[model samples]
Target chain A: MLCLIAWVVFGILGLFSVKYRVLAKESFDCVFRRITFKKCNSNLDERIKSKLTGNLMKFSPKMARGVYRHYEFLSWIFVALFVVSLVLGAQGAYNLAMYDNCAGPNADPDQCIFTPDYDVVDCDDPLCDDGHCEECGDDCDCEECS
Target chain B: MMNVEKIRKDFPIFEKKKFIYFDNACMPLRPKVVIDKINEYYTEYPACAGRSYHDFGTRLTDEVANARDLVKKFIGAKKAKEIIFTKNATESINLVANSFKFNSVLTSDREHNSNLLPWQKFDHDVVKSKKDFSFDLESFSDKVKNFDIVSMVHTSNLEGYSLPVKEIIKIAHEQGAKVLLDGAQSVPHKEINVRKLDVDFLAFSGHKMLGPNGVGVLYGKEELLDGMKPFILGGETVSDSTYDSYKLEELPHKFEAGLQNYPGILGLGSAAKYLMKIGRNNIEKHENMLKSKIDIEGVEKIGHVGESGIFNFNIPGKGAHEVAMMLSASKNIMIRSGAHCMHSWFNSRNLEGSARASFYLYNTLEEIDTFVEELEKIKKL
Candidate 1:
């Protein structure tokens, strides 16, 4: 607690220092601030963009042809990852939302809904094993002998 | 042009399924006349080609030789003796490659494997292709002097690229070299003047040009064929035989050494007649017109290798095998996928290879519309 208080006091004193005041003035001033940030924006990576373009330009027609190809490659990777994540997240959320009600006696508001007859999906083709789908073993494996 | 609807009737596949078969690079489904010829040979007088004493066999032999004459005329050869029969274009090429005495050979990666592989793995000194998959006339000419044979495909199977055959032939002759062309893709779709091209040899398949399977043609300069020894030796190829020594048959027969499929020969002969009647110039225009519109954008990552009516494109996420299964099941459209027995070339290009849709003469515009629609649907998936 004391260390936190001390640190806050030191920060306050630093803010009031001569060098600090000039810095604040410089940042708040619109024109100078604009010049500094636009030239050195941390969020927008101008260097990486330039580097990418340079590499892209150096490529001969053949090399330029190759790869994911042009900017479409980057887009494809992004799209693939985005699609995979969205699907996985949706599946996870759905599983969580239905977990308890999936086998609960009071199916209302349960995480998962249970069928009394357990005949919803037929898994009898080896995957279901002897016509059972809902009755799982001690290891939580499904048995399809119904 | 030429009342395509009326022409399409001659090819029975259009009657069965209204499809535009742009995949002629793969193979052409036989026409009714060719198919009927095959059926007649089988039912009426099915006999081995080239040799016989009986009436049916002699008729069959005469028909087979007549087929050779038809092919020679079709390609504008000096003599029918220049033509050699084989199973297909692939075997015809293999025969030439195996027999041709070469210190070195020059071709390009632009070639289908039939033309390229003959020399790439050949125990010869030098086998060279273009740095990229494009053709270079100057490079080819400069190198021709050093190489013994300059074997190249007349038009690339991938791009439908037509090479400067006449110029290349002249260059090869100047260098005292021989040239062979793979016309398997070009012959069925385009008109070729082999005499004008002056190439030493040409090979093409029957199946790709609206004929039956188990039939192909290899056209060599008469002198060259007479000098070179035959590859396969069996019962029919021999002129006379003794226990110790046997003299081989001359010209086309020397190259063909077995009991031939006379049905297949007559079918191919009819196919040649079909081309002659249709006029190759009109067919080239019609097929190219379809090719010009095919949407190759779906496979832009691999891109269309060439828009020469053999549309080759590779999908990024889909391997050709999986894509082929999906296409077969989801859409009634059929396409040939995988490396096409050219794994080495595909591997060198850092690709698993591509799916191909090759087009031919009988294929209609409506079929292309269906193909494009299916391709668009496939892209969405």
Candidate 2:
């Protein structure tokens, strides 16, 4: 389960750096073995677990013990969070493409980064400049007055 | 008493790397002297031995012969011709396996893959170890009569326990069986005299004993070696050859096939000299003292933590590799994990593997404390 997440993370990092490529390949092998219902021969997950636990042991033994004991449960939680984020990201991408708003058509455009800012002024006012009045129509909801 | 601190100075790796190295059973760190000797061969005389008459070649040939003589003295062999250099202990064993005339062969259940794999083609029998993981002499005595040769590991790399080879050899000899002891683990740590042991054949590697890799020694009795055929036939192996008829070289040269590893041989000779200067008995005592200091609770020991330098164990609920990796991560403590190349023994005992911390003369009490302290933290986890 950790290998799946590691593969995605390392696979991306592997494109930029040469160091992570071997680890990326190892994690991919682990994930492939797991999917095929075979044990991971690479022991990449064990290396990661031991390294993490060992680093944690230096600062807090109790916390390290807890993490070591509940590693499987924590892996499941991490996998769940990763899957949820991936789904949410896909949904946001789809919304931005379909409705031109990552927050959806019913949601506020201010919440979406893709939403362009609009400059508007009331043309009914007497103080309205000529440049502003020309761009502003009867309803006056213009993006650029000039 | 061995001056371990002073001894540590001889190995150059300590100056560069800051780590507690406890993987000596697999390969001991080479001293500067051994390294220099290897470098000397390349810088001074980088030529084929025995074939050339130039100054470089003459010097190399002499050096190679000197290395063989040193190995012969190291193992207490009667003649230098008895010493045959091979790639490693595995090749040495395979050489004997291929050349020796034997209908059946017997080995202990805890044989390493090197000792076990070569005999798989022959009619092989295994004498099982006792429940306590000790070599079973009674069972071996019973099985000795049925086999033509009795091959066994002199000291187990798995747990560092030595078999009663003196007794085992006597029993096998009485049954008219030849004995070949794999001394890879034993020869490095303790003093082994082939003549005193009266063993027919002995095989050991150079890298495991502070020597360079790609060189190992096989010591066989002169009479026995004379009877066996050459394991490999090549340029150096033949003294004269016709189109259809060829006369083989004598003794050691007959077995050494191609252009030999001259640098490795010189390094191994230097290693032998270094060990002799330090004294093997002092080394054994130092290792015993170091092993005695290791005391960690709440762990399942693989075998009895005997007087040998190796300490193999498994922290409860943790894999062997996990414990080893944790120790490495915590303090850069190097150790060995897995079956230690004795998979058949582990499989028979229903164990995955063990974490092994093998000490040598360079290892100290402080390193043992660090190892124990890290193991304590791991046990808690």
Candidate 3:
């Protein structure tokens, strides 16, 4: 549980630092090794797992033997989730950098983006009586603005 | 008494997920409305409160003040001015310990570290809990007379054993000692009436009660707060200041120094509203119902499973941490293990720790049954 929590945190921090991204990738590698039943070289994952589940050994040797086998599956699942989160968070940050906001295409631009005048952003039609464009007016389809 | 399905729908964490959360003692899952409120702040009006006179600043100030009022009502405080917002319960307790005037302090063995370390600066005496996980009231009574302040945990996170605070407060008052209730566990799970308890100070964390992290409450009596010194000092806490002479602001404002957490406080206000709408009495009843029928084979209970949502136990021969880990890995179940920050209680009894599963309003009977089934599998392991 502690290991997964750390990975999730590091994954979030990976957004700001490449060093954290490296650490998260190493952690993910450890999880991947467990999934493939490879000879794991990373002692950090094993140490964390042992320290966390150490109480079980004292509680009952039998229970420890039974449940320890499943730790690998949990590690894999957590790493997978961390990867997804890191990818989506990066994508959002990328979108926000390129555009003023990272809102979904279907999202209302008024609520998602900041602007002094809504009229300028929404005015898609060249023809306008007042500053508001009639095509993108109250009954406008609103797709052309996006 | 609450509609479980309807209540669960309010929380987005449950959406598109079949996972069960029993970590309420650590941090409760936030509701969608609270998340929406947070997002709304950053998107629409991201401005500092009490620092500007513009439209955005005025709206932010009102939101912060409104949040303080909501917290005051939630804990049954005498006035809104009595509520001081801090980062968490640890900060709140530290604030009272550092600010209050006291020569000696009294606490108990079952206290979390937040309630313990803050008093170590003074001549502190600790009353131990009995072997059965109950507080030794006689020890408390004998020690109360020697201390000027009685700081205590309202409920033990280890066993969910609630201290007899009303009677304890009466005894402390008779001995001319002011009391501080560590309401971290009690405030979220039970209804807290500071006015009725008559405690001088009450501290609790918002995250443990379905609100955002990094936001908590330190509620003091209006008079006591006025008398106590400020914990943190900077821009927001001062009215007027010079090189050598400075004047602090009144009540809550004096304690809340620096830029405040406006979004988090708004989230907490929403959490308070959510809890109130469901009714605290109903939550208590539902949790009690869940605690009563908790069935497990060959597990040893650490403390009395009273009228609380907390359950602490160990597999007869299985280590508590092992059980917690195995359950999480195999079933995605989350339960707390270890000393639970009550090292004094566990070390005194020659025990390491017990596995703890805490429930909240969002928890269901189905989750408990699933937990027991997983426990059965761990027994085979």
lDDT per residue (tens digit) for residues B1-381 in model 2: 888889999999999999999999999899999999998988988999999999999999999999999998888999999999999999999999999999999999989999999999999999988888888999999989999999999999987899999999999999999999999999998998999999999999999999999999999999999998986899899999999988999988999988999999999999998998898888988888888898877878887457787888888899999988888888899999999998998898899999999989899999999999989999888
Candidate with the greatest TM-score versus the true structure: 2
Please state the CAPRI-style docking class of candidate 3.
incorrect
Give the Cα error of residue B321 in candidate 1, in Å: 4.0
How far in Å is the alpha carbon of B83 misplaced in model 3? 0.3
For model 3, what is the alpha-carbon lDDT of residue B327?
A: 72
**Backbone clashes in model 2, listed as residue pairs:** none
Q: What are the per-model DockQ values? A: 0.01, 0.63, 0.06
**Tens digits of lDDT, candidate 3, B64-145:** 8888888889999989999999998999999999999989999987789999988887899888777666778888888899
Residues A1-146 of candidate 1 have per-residue lDDT tens digits of 11122233344665869764443343334223343554422211222232233243234323423421344455346546666876776765555456533333354543333322333444443455555433443333345344
What's the TM-score of chain A alone for every prediction?
Answer: 0.25, 0.77, 0.45
Ranking by TM-score: 2, 3, 1
Instruction: Provide the global lDDT of candidate 2 against the true structure.
Output: 0.90
Question: Which consecutive 10 residues in model 1 chain B have the weakest lDDT in total?
Answer: B123-132
Ranking by DockQ: 2, 3, 1
iRMS of each prediction: 16.4, 0.8, 7.9
Worst 10 residues of 2 chain B by lDDT: B303-312
Contacts from the true interface found in each model, as a fraction, amount to 0.00, 0.80, 0.11
